[model samples]
Structure formats: C-alpha cells, structure tokens
Target: MSSLISIVLPVFAVIGLGWLAQRRGWLGDGGAGALNAFVFRIALPPLLFLAMARTPFEAFGQWRFLAAYLSGTAGVWVLVWWLAPRLGFNGFQARWLTCLGATFSNAIYLGIPLFETAFGALSAQPVILIALMMNLLLVGGSLIVLQAVSGEGTRAAIKETLSNPMLFAIGAGLLVSWFDIALGDGADRLLSLLAQAASPVALFALGVTLGVAGSGVRFGRPQWVLLVAKLFVHPALVALACWGFQADAINAQAAILIAAVPAGSLVHVVAARRGTLETESAALILLTTAVSVVTLTLLLEWLL
Candidate 1:
C-alpha cells in the first residue's frame, strides 16, 4: 500500500496532469501525437537499444516467461473469440476488437513508467522480451489479419514489423552484444539521457491522448465485459501461467504487471484506421486505464 501511494500514485498523477493539461488547452492541437511520435521514433529506440545491448544472452533465454505470457494471450484470444458473438460483437472486425481489447496491453506507455519505477534498469529485460513477442506476433499478426480480411498481401505486414525502429533497435542491440562491441562513454551517456526521458514523457502523452479522444462512449455490457477481461481475467491467467512455468519471482511479477495494465493505445489506433469499432476501442482505452488504478494498486500490494 505504501508502495502504491508513494511510487504508483505519482506515476498516475503525471498522467492525470497530462489529461488536465489537454482539457485546459495547454497541449494545443496535435501536441500529444507529436510527443508520442518523438517517444516512438527517437527516445525509446535508443533507450531500448542500450537496454538490450547491456542485457546478457542468458537473460534472453527466458522461454518460460515467453510461454507464460503467450499462453495467457492465447487464452484470452480464444475466450473472446468464442464469447464475442454471443455478446453481440458480431462480424470479424467487431469480434477482433473484442479479442484485441482483452489481449493487448498498454505495455509501452503506462507500462514502462511503472516498471522503471519498480524494477529500475532491469525493467528493460522483460520489456525487450515482451516487445519482441508482442510486436512480432500480436501486432504484426493483426496487420496480417487486416490485410487478409481486406484482400491484400500479408507480406507488407511482415515488412512493416521488420521496419519498426524499436524492433530495429532490439536487433541492432543484440548484434552489438553478440559481437561484444564497445559503445564507449559518449554514446552511453547520450543513450542514458534519451532513455530517461522516455518514461515520463510517454505517460504524459498517453494522458493527453485520452483527454483528446474517447469523450463520447457509453459504458454498456460489452464495455463491462472488456473491462473485466482486461483488468482481471488476463492478469489472473498470466499469473497462473507464470507459476505453472516456474518463472522466477521477478519475471512472474513483471508478467503480471504488464498483463494488469489497460488495453494498448495501438488497439484504438488500429480500429480508427480500419474504420471499425472506433467508439468501442476508445471507450475500452479510457475505461481500462481508469480501472487499472485500482487493479494495479491491489496487484502491487500483493506482488511487491
């Protein structure tokens, strides 16, 4: 509880400040997007690169952690697929949104800040691991589904995944580590500075985005279902998977924390681009984030 009030509260408070800033017109037009773009393209890449570069090859061999996270994600996807139609989310797009809502997590924005606070530099290990899986499998897979559903080639999706700067960073960092390349003092300092900026800035940008969007969604049965699934069911499944896999204490806690976060902002972005379930996706983003405060606090109280 003290951990929640001291560390976690301040983090969410930053997001609240971002939201308040947006509502008061302090962020202006397109500010959040620009900030997010900076984090995505510049700050985070170097941060991630340095983190991966510093991690030992042995740490990346945590197949149990991957298995646990993947099992939980797969479970959610199957559960949602089977239950969505009965719950009125008919058609492929709607059902996919529901499945996405349950499985996808705000791993980059809200996640990084929390992990940085709790786990410090070690936070990057699980982050790099999750990013590799989440970006390649879930996010890229979504693109493939979209292209396939729309009668296009899936090759483009694979290319897009390969071209992602963060993914590029992870790969580059791994190569450097493999060769034992020396980055020296200047480069190290530069990366540290950039990585330090990624967390707070990302959280602020997230809050502004929420404030700017998702203003008109009404909470209903589907919304409640998504809320419960994302905050509760997903976390529980991941925790169980971690225990079954005999993950180390640190990995188990990290996996559970990531699972307990809100739906990914990317979920809403994908929905808007595809012109389907925009309102519902927006609503899920807002509601899950708001509700995660309680869920995460309770989780931290136990996990920490």
Candidate 2:
C-alpha cells in the first residue's frame, strides 16, 4: 500500500501543481498548448525513440500480452459503442466519444510516469509497447470507425497516423535496435536528457488542460457511463484477460495497470476536431483521471 502511494501520490501531486498553476493564473492562456507542443515534439519523441531502440525483438514475443490487452481493450470499445445507443447516447459523435472515454487510456501523459515510478525506467519496454499498442489500435481504429459511420474520410486518418513523429521514432528505433546500430555516447545522452523531461512536462500540460477545459460541464449520463466503464469495467476486463491468457506475472501486472489509466486526451481532441461532445469529453477525461488515483492504488495493492 505504501509503495502504491509512493507511486501514485507524487504523480498526482505534480498534476495538481499544474492545475493550481493554471487556476492561479500562473500559466498563460496558451501555456498548456506550448507545453504540449514541447512535450510532443521535443520530449516524447526522443523518449519513445530511446525506448524502442533498446527494446529487443525478443521482448516482442509476448503475444500473450498483446492478446490479453487487445481482447480487453477491444472488448471495452465494442461493448461501449453497442451500449451507447441503448443508453440514449444518440448520434455517431456522442457514442464515439463515450466509447473513447471508456476505452482510451492516458498512456503517454500519465501511464509512462506511473509505470516509471513503480517499475523503474528500465521497465519502459512494456510501458512503451503498451502505449504504442493503445495508440495504434484505439486511436487509429477510432478514425476508421468514424469514417465508416460519420462520412469522415479515412484518408486524413491514414495520413495523420503515417506522419506521426512518435510512430516514426518507434520505427526508427526498432530498425536501430534490430540491426544493432550504435549511436555514440553523446547522441544517446542527449536523447536521454530529452526523454527524462517527457513525463513531468506532459503531466503538467495535462493538468493545465484540465484546468482550462474540465470545468463548467455538469455531470450527465455520459459522465456517469465514463465513470463506471473507465474506472471499473475496463480494468476488470483486462485483469480477467490477463488471467485467461496466462500472461507472465510481470506483463500481466503491467497490462492490467495500463488498462486502468484514465481517459486519454485524444478523446477530447477527436471530439473538438469533429465538433462533437467537447464538454462531456473533457469532463470524462477529468473525472476518470481524478478517480483513477483511488482505483489504481487499490488495484496495485491487490496485484502486489
């Protein structure tokens, strides 16, 4: 329990500091945007690059881990989308937003930091793998779903996915790792410095974003669904899948923890870009993030 607190509290505290900074007007109106730009362009790409560069192809043999994670995550996505209409969440955008809120984990901004804190930076193999998996499957698939239903062209989605710097970094890192290309000590150290900044800055930017957009939205049916689905149903399914797949202990625990993270920023991004349920999406992201502290802490105590 104490260990879990040690991991969970400090991360949330930094996020809270950012929220406070935003609320107190310490951050300018564009502060969150600027910080996010830096994190995405400067910090995260190097972090992912380094992580993939170090990850051996042998680690990719954990098909069981991917099997479990995919089953759980995709299961949540399908279930939420199917149930949304029945629950009176009408329209493609609304249902998609609800499904996204339920299934998308904040793997980048929050998951990396928490996993690094709990399991150490060397364990970032699974962390990065899981993050990459989530982004590709969930976010990528969301666009396809939107295209099929809402008449949005999948061409844009394909372009965006192909052009993403993080994915490019991951691919480059994999080639380097696989072929054993050695970047010298200086380049490695430079990347390491940038990588170190990804977590805190990303978390701070997330908090600032929440401070900017998470308010003025009253709790509604969507929020209620997000509350239960994100915090409970999704994680529970992932844990069950882990057991079912007989995943190795370490990967099983990591997979479960990854599933337990909050609604990701991409949910809001999708909603905002498409002019959908922005307020509710923001509320879902904020609500799930706040509640995951308790939920994940309990989960870690049990898993440990």
Candidate 3:
C-alpha cells in the first residue's frame, strides 16, 4: 500500500500542479505549446534514445511480448472501428478517431513516467519496447486510416511519421545498440542531462493541455465507450495475451500497465489537423487521463 502511494501520489501531484497553474493563469498564452515543444523536441528523444541505446540487443528479440501486446491493441482498434458506425459515429473521421482513442496509449508522456516511478528506471526495458511498438503501429497506422477516411493524401501522414523525432531516435538507438557503438562519456552525459527533464515537464505539459483543450467540453455515451474501451478492455486483453503467451511476470505486468494508460493527445492533434471530431477527441483525452489516476493506482497495487 505504501509502495503504491509513494509511487502514484507524487506523479499525480505534479500533474495537479500544472492543472492548477493553468487554471490560475500562472503560465501565459501558448505556455502549454512551449512546454510541449521542449518535451517532445528536446527531452523525450534523448530519454528514449538512451533507454534504447543502452538496452541489450537481445531485448529487441522479445517477439512473444510484442505479439501479445500488439494483438490486444489491434483487436481493440478493429472492434472500435466496426462498432463506431453502429454507434452513430458513421463518418469516416469519427470512426477513425474512435478507433484511435480506443487503442492509442499515452506511452511517452504518462507510461514512461509512471513505469519509471513504479518499477525503477533500470526496469524500463519492457515499457520502452511497448512504447516503440505503439509508436510504429498505432501512430503510423492512424495516419493511414485518416488518409483513407478523409481523402487526405498519404503524403502528409507519411511525412509526419517519418519526421517524428522520437521514431528517429528509437531507430538510431537501436542501430547503435545493434552495432555495438560506444558514445563516449561526453555524449552520454549530455544525453543523461536532457533525459532527466522528460518526466516532470511532460506531466506539467499534459495538465496544461488538458486545461486548454477540455474547455467547455461535455461527455456522452460515445465518450463513455471510448473511456471504457481504453482504460479497461484494452488492458484486459493485453493481460490475457500475456498469459496465453506465457510471458515473464515482470514483462506481463509492464505490458498490462502500458495498455492501461490514457489515450494519447496525438489522437486529438490528428483529429484537429484533419478537422474532424476535434472537440470530442480533446474531451476524451481529458476524461481518460483524469480517470486513469485511480485505475492506474489500483492496477499498480494489484500488479506489484
């Protein structure tokens, strides 16, 4: 109990601080964007890079874990995609957004920080692997879905995915690890310094984003569907997959926790960019994040 509180409380407190700051106007106009830019462009890339670069090459060969996790995610996506039309989200954009909200986990902003707190940084290999897979599969796949639904050319989606610094960092890190290249002490220290800033900054930025984007939003039955699918169904499927695959206990728990994270803000970003379901997508992000605090804490207690 104490272990769970110790891990969960401080993370939520920082997020709460950011929410309060935004509510109080402590950060002026565009503050959230600036913070997000810093985290995405500067802090998170190095963190992911270092995590991947330092990981053993064999860690990349965990095919069973990957299969289990991706299977759960893909299942939820397909289920949401098919159900959206029946649920009155008949438009392609609406259907795509619903599918995205169901499967996309906030792996970078929330998962990494929470996992680092609960399991220790040295134990983040599973989280990193899952994050990488989510980025490639969920994020990349969203672009293709959007293009198909909205008649938007695949060029923009392809460009966005290819230009993602986090994806590039992951690839570079894996390459370095695969080739056994050493980035001497000087480079290591620089990366370590940048990596140290990812968690707190990301949490704060998330709070600010919630405040800004969730303004005047109202939830309905569809929103409830999205929340339940993301927070419960997805994780349950991942846990079942882990058991079926006979994964190690730690990796199994890690996969379930990652799957339980809230829907990513990227869903909202994509919806807004495509001019479809932007407000609802933002509301879903806020609701899922606010609710995930309790869900995640409970899951951590059970898993630990």
Candidate 4:
C-alpha cells in the first residue's frame, strides 16, 4: 500500500496541479497542446531511444517474461470487449475505448516516475520492457481497434499508424537498438535533454485535453465498468501472468504496478481522432485516474 501510494499519489498531484494551472489560465489554453506536442514529438522519442539504446541486449534473456506481460494485457482487452456491451457500452465504444483502456498504459509518464521512486535506476529495465510492448501495441494494435470500432477496415488504419510521427520515432529507435550503434557524447547529451521534458509536458497535455469543450467524460455505469477492469481486474491478471512466467520479484511488482495505471492519455487523442465514444473515453481516463491511487495502493500491498 505504501509503495503504490508513494508512487501514484505524487504523480497525480503533478497532474492535478497542471489541471489547476490550466483552469486558472496560468499557462494559457494552448499551453497543454504545445506541451503534448513537445513531449510526443521530441521528448518521448529521445526517452524511448535512450532507454532502448542503454539496455544491454544480453539482459533480454527472459523472452517469456515479456510474452506473458503482453499476452495478459491483450487477454484482458479481449475480455473487456466481450463484456463491454453487457456493461452498457455500445459495440464501437466498447471495442475501441476498452482497448484504449486495456492496452496502452501511462507507463512512460506515470511508470518512469513511480519506478524511479520505488526501485531507482534498476527499475528502468522492467519499465523499458513494458514500454517496448507498448510501442508494439500502439503502433499495431491501437490502429486495429480503431478500425474495428469504426467498421473502417484495415487500410485506413494502417495508413494512420504508419504515418504517426511518434510511431515513426519508435521504429527509428528500434533500428538504432537493432544495429547496436553507440550514440556519441554530444548526441547522448542531446537525447538526455529532450527526454527530461517528457513527463511534465505529457501530463499537462492530458490536463488540457480534459478541459476541452467537448472532452468532458461522464461517469456512469459503463465508465465504472471500464475503470474497474483497468484498476482491479487487469492488475490481478497481470500478477498471475507474471508469476506464471516465473518473473523475478521486481519484474512481477512492476507488471502489476504498470497494469494499475489508468488508461493512456493517447486514448483520448485517438478517440477524438476516430470520432468514436470521445466523451466515454474521456470519462474513463478521468475516473480511472482519480480512483487508481487507492486501488493501486491496495494492489501493491497485497501483491508486493
């Protein structure tokens, strides 16, 4: 409990502060978008690149560990999709939004900060492993969900994912990692500098999106169902999956903690772009985020 609270509360406090800042017009209305753009286009790329670049490929011995973590996430997504309509969500809304909630975690913004606080630099290994899976899902699976929800078929979705700048950066970073090229000192420093801006900007962007005119998420039965799935069911399954895969203690804890995060901020962005369940998607983000502090804390105490 202490571990989860220690991590989730402070991060959400930062987000709350950003929300207040936006509400008070301290940073101006456009500040959030600019922050998001900076983080997504510049900060996140360098962060992902540096993270991948620094990982000694030899440490990636436990392929099953990564497999279990990702497979568990996908499994939960499928469950959410099947149960969403019964839970009061429409088919399109349930499929995409449930996936948005299930798949991509706020692992970068929230996970890095929490992992750093709880376990220090050593935690970066598991976090990056999770991030790598996130890259794959965001690039591949997110598009699939959008297409399925919209009944738009595969071609348009593929085009959008391929053309996404953030996905392109992820692909480029993987290439650098695959080739095992060492970054020069100056280049390394530059990457470090850009990477440092990722969290604040990402959170602020979320705040701005939250404040958008049509972006308010309403908390009704359907939203609560998604929240429960994300905060409780997903974490429990992830823990079992991690244990089944024989993940080390730290890796297991990281899996559950990462799973405990609310829906990804990108979900709102995708929801808006796809024009499917935007309000419901926003509601899931806000509600899950608000409730996760307690739920995650409880999970940590029980699991840890």
Candidate 5:
C-alpha cells in the first residue's frame, strides 16, 4: 500500500508542478510539443537503450508475458471500437478515436517514473519493454485506425509512422540491445544524463500540452465514448488478461500500472492532424490523466 503511494505521488507531483508552471506562465503555452519532441527524440532513446542493455533478454523472452500484455491491450481496443458505435459515434470518426484512446497510454512520461518508484531499478526492463510496445502500437495501430477513421491516404500515414523519431529511436535501442553493443564509459555517461532528463522534461511538456487542451472546446458523444474506453474498459480488460495469463507479481503489477495510464496526451495532436474529434481527443487526454492519479493508486495497492 505504501509502495503504491510512493509510486503515484511523485508522478502526480511532477505533473502538478508542470501544471503550476503553466498556470503561472513559467513555461510558455504549447511548449508541450517541444518538450515531448525532446524526450521522444533525445532523452527517451538512450533511456530505452540503456534500460534494455542491462536487462537480461532471457527474462523477458517469455511469449506468455508478451501475449498477455498485447492481448490485454487488443481486447480493450476492440471493446472501445464496439462501444463507440453503440454510443452513437458512427463511421470513421468513432473507429479511429476509439482505437486511439483504447490503445494509447502515457506510458513513457508517467509509466516510467511511477514504475521506477514502485519496483526499484529493475523496473526499467518492464518499463522499457512496455514503452517499446506502446510506441509500436502508436505508430502502427494508431496510423491504421486513423487512416480508416479519417479515410485519409494510407500511404501518407504509413510514411509518417516510418519517419517518426520515437519509432526510429526504439528501433535503434532494440538493435543496440540485441547486438550486445554497449555505450561504453564516456558515451554511457552522456546517454545516462540524457535518460535521466526524460521524465522531468516530458512531464513539463505534458503540462504545457494540458494547458492547451484545457482551453479547447469539448464534450459530446465522442468525449463520453472515449472517456469510458480509456478510463474504464482498458483497465478492466488488462486486469482480466493479467489473471488469465497467471502473471507473476511483478508482471501483474506492471500490467496493471500500464493499463491504468490515461490516453496519451498526444492523441489530440494525432486527431487534429488527421481531422477527427480534435477537441474531444485533447479533453479526454487531460481528463483521464487527472483521474488516473486516484485510479492508479488504488489499483496499484490492490494489484500489489
């Protein structure tokens, strides 16, 4: 129980600090993108690589863990997709945003910090694997759903995913890990510095993004559907998956934490870019994030 508090409070503190910074105009508006870009491009890559390098691949080599996690995510995605239409979100709009909200998570920003706090240094492996998995889902799953929802050019979305800096970084990190190449002493030190910077910068950026999202106009069927999918259905499905897989304590805890995260704040950006429910997407990201502090804390205590 104390571990749950230990994990969640610091994260909400950072987020609250960022929100306070934005509220005070200490950080400029819309700077979240810049902060997100920095983490995604620079800070996160090294973090991922270093985390993976140290983790024994043999430990994570279990297909059951991978399948369990992926299936949990997929089950939520489908539930959201089905429910959105039932809630009166028809056509591509419902499909795309439902898919986005159901699958995407604020894993890198909130997930890493929270897990590290709860589990110790070894948390990095699960966090890294989860981050990598989410990134792949974001690029591939997000694009495909968006394309289907918006009826946009599939070729263009594919290109954008391929060109995404985060995806490229994850790939590089995995490659470095697989090949057994170390960053060495000097380079390792530098990369470690950058990796350490990821959480703070990303959280601050999240604040700026939230500020922007807060100002946006929202609410309607779309918002309702998205909120339920992200806040309720996703976590429920993840819990079931964890039980079904008979995951160990650590894996089960990790899965629950990952499941409890809100929709990625950047889902709004994706929606805006693709011409979907921009306001609602942004709003849900902000709303779910706020609610998640309580939701995650409770779930963690229960799962742990």
Candidate 6:
C-alpha cells in the first residue's frame, strides 16, 4: 500500500496543482495551451528520442510482448469502432473519437512517470517500447481515420502522419540506435535537459486543460462506455494476451499497466484541431484520469 501511494500520490498531486492554478487564474487565459505546446513540440520529443536511443535494439525484439500488447490495444480500438454507431456515436467524427478514447493510453505524460516511480529507471524500457507502438499504430491510425472520414485525400493524411514530431523523434532515435550513432557529451546533456522537463510540465498542463476545457463536460452513457473500455476492457485484453502468449513476467506486467493508463489528452487535442467531438473527448480525458487514480492504485498493488 505504501509503495502504491508513493508512486500514485505525487503524480495526481501535480495534476491537481495544475487544475487549482488554472481555476484560480494563476496562469491566465490560454496558459495551458502554452504548456501543452512545449510538451508536445519540445520536451516530449526529446524524451522519446532519449528513451529510444538509450535502449538496446535487442529489447525491441521482444516479439511476444509486442504482439500481446498491440493485439490487445488494437482489439479494443476495433471493438469501439464497430460499436460506436450502435451506441449512438453515429457520425464519423464520433466514431473516431470513440476509437481514440478506447485505445489511446496516456503513455508519455502519465505512464512514464508512474512506471518509473513504481519500478525504477529500468522501467522506462518497457514503457517506451509500448509508447512507440502506441504512437505509431494508434495515433497514426486515428489521423488516417479522421482524415478519411472528413473526405481528405490519402496523400494529405500520409503527409500529416509523417510530419508528426513525436513520430519523427521515434524514427530518428531508432535510426540512431540502428547505426550505433553516439551523441557526444554536450549533445547528450542537451537532450537530458529537455527530457527532464517533460513529466511535471505535462501533468500540470493536463490539469490546466481539465480546469479550462473540461468544466462543462457532463458525464453520461458515452462517458461510461469510454471509461469502461479504456480502464477495464483494454487492460483485460492485454492480460489475456499475456496469458496466451506466455510473455515474460515483467514484460506482461508492464504491458498490463500501460494498458491501464487513462485516455491520452491528445485525443482532446486532435478533436479540437479537427473541430469534432472536442467536448466528449475532454470529458473522457477528465473522467478517465480521475477514475484512474483508484484503478491505477489497485493495479499497482496487484502488479507490484
């Protein structure tokens, strides 16, 4: 219990502080966007690059682990996509939002810190491994779905996906590792500085976003469906995959934990950018994040 509290409390506290700051007007209007921009465009990319560059390529070869995790996530995504219309999320944008909420874990902002605190620096390996797959498959896939549904050409969707900074960083890092490229001490130091800023800033920014944008989102049936899919169905599928694939104990635990993270705030970002389902996405982020406090704590106690 103490271990769980030590890991979970500080993370949510930072988020709560950001919420309080926003509610109290400490950062003024649009302050959260500034912080989120820094996180998305600057801090997060470097952090991802460092994570990928530092990990051995052999670690990426954990095929069973990757298969288990991806299958679980992809399954949930597909399930939501199929069920959305029946659930009254009948529009293309609405279905896209449902799919995003179902599969998009808050891997970078919340998962990284939570796993690192619970399991130590070595925990980054599994977390980043999952993050890479999530970014590639879920994020890129969602963009394609949104663009396709909005009647954008395939070229446009492809271009947008290729231009994603996070995806670019992941690719660059993989290339660096593949070629055994070494950044000299100075460059390494620079990346370290930028990477160090990602977690606290992201958590705080998420809180601010919740305060500013999540205020009017009333929980309803759709919110309940999203929460259940994200926090329960997703992780259960991952656990089932672990069992079927006989993944290594540590890897299986990491996969399940990653699956249990709340919906990513990026869902809301994408909705806002596309002028679709913004309020519903925000509600999912806020509610899942709040509920995750309890769900993640139980998970930590069980897995740790």
lDDT string for model 5 (1-304, tens) is 7767777887787887777777777756556667777888889777777776666656667555556778878887777777777766677665766677667888878878777776775576775677667766764667776676556667876776677665666567667767777677998899889988987777767766777677756666666666667767777777788788887667767766787788887677777766777776777787788888888888778765
* Predicted candidate 6 versus true structure: per-residue lDDT over 142-169, tens digit per residue: 7787777778855866777778788888
Return the clash pairs for model 3, or none.
none
Give me candidate 5's TM-score against the actual structure. Answer: 0.88
State which candidate has the highest lDDT. Answer: 3
TM-score of 1: 0.96
Each candidate structure's TM-score, on Cα atoms with residue i matched to residue i, is 0.96, 0.95, 0.95, 0.85, 0.88, 0.92
Instruction: List ranges where model 2 is wrong by over 4 Å.
Output: none
For each candidate, the alpha-carbon lDDT, in order, equals: 0.84, 0.85, 0.87, 0.71, 0.73, 0.86
What are the per-residue Cα lDDT tens digits for candidate 2 across 223-264? 877678887888889889988999988888888888898989
lDDT of 3 by residue, 197-246 (tens): 99999988988887778888898888888899999999999999998998
lDDT of 4 by residue, 1-304 (tens): 5557766677667777777777777887578777777776778777766766676666567566676678778788888878877876666754656666666677866776666666765456677668657755664567676677568788877776566565566566666777788889999898888877776666666656555522444689877877878887787788778878888777777787888877877777677776777787777778877787777667656754
Give model 2's TM-score versus the native structure.
Answer: 0.95
Name the lDDT value of residue 87 in candidate 5. 65
Better of 1 and 3 by lDDT: 3
The candidate, 1 or 3, that scores higher on TM-score is: 1
Which 10-residue span in candidate 2 carries the lowest summed lDDT?
Answer: 144-153
Predicted candidate 1 versus true structure: per-residue lDDT over 185-295, tens digit per residue: 998999889988988898998898888776778777888898888899998999999999998888788888999989988888778867888888888899999988888
Instruction: State the local distance difference test value for candidate 4.
Output: 0.71
Q: Per lDDT, what order, best first?
A: 3, 6, 2, 1, 5, 4
- The top-ranked prediction according to TM-score is 1
